[model samples]
Target: MKEESSVSRLQIMSVMGLSKQRNYLLTQYLQAIQLPRGFGGDLVFEFQVSQGRVRHLVLDEQASSLKEQTVMELIRRSLLAWLPEESRSNR
Candidate 1:
């Protein structure tokens, strides 16, 4: 399992290299998962579906830096705040 801090909004966007067409899909399902302990930071949840079965997994974020975690939180909040504006403009 990987740490949640190992991944970021910018990193996912970088990995997927989503175009304008797919950007809406990402924004549509933006989510946040927290660790069961509910002590420090967020957790990462991953789901996979195949020809056989689907699996659910949660990632840890124990050693993440304060700066590392906050940046993503800030970005997430900013995106959430901007979503309404984006929708209106897209119409």
Candidate 2:
């Protein structure tokens, strides 16, 4: 992982679009682990795999300026719902 944000909203959106456009079999399972305000008000999104590979995306600077509630709503509407079904068994 990189010190800078490894994942961004645009990157995630691009993946979603590519999945559709290319008809690739990709499953993205995202869960809101917790609201870690101590970490500069970041909302943590954890992407888990059955093989024990876990990737986390902390919505820090990208969402730092927004209220907690607003951030949550934005995530729910834009990111969460766009995530593909959990293909844990396949992984």
lDDT: which candidate is best?
2
Off by over 4 Å in 1: 1-67, 84-86
Over 21-78, each residue of candidate 1 has an lDDT whose tens digit, in order, gives: 4455445535332212223333342433222222332233453333355444554443
Q: Estimate the lDDT of model 1.
A: 0.37
Score every model by TM-score.
0.27, 0.25
Clashes of 2: 0
Best-matching candidate per TM-score: 1
- TM for candidate 2 is 0.25
For each of the candidates, give the backbone clash count: 0, 0
- Candidate models: Cα lDDT each: 0.37, 0.39
lDDT of 2 by residue, 1-91 (tens): 5566523321132232233522233323233333333323345444332232323434444644545575466564444334334333445
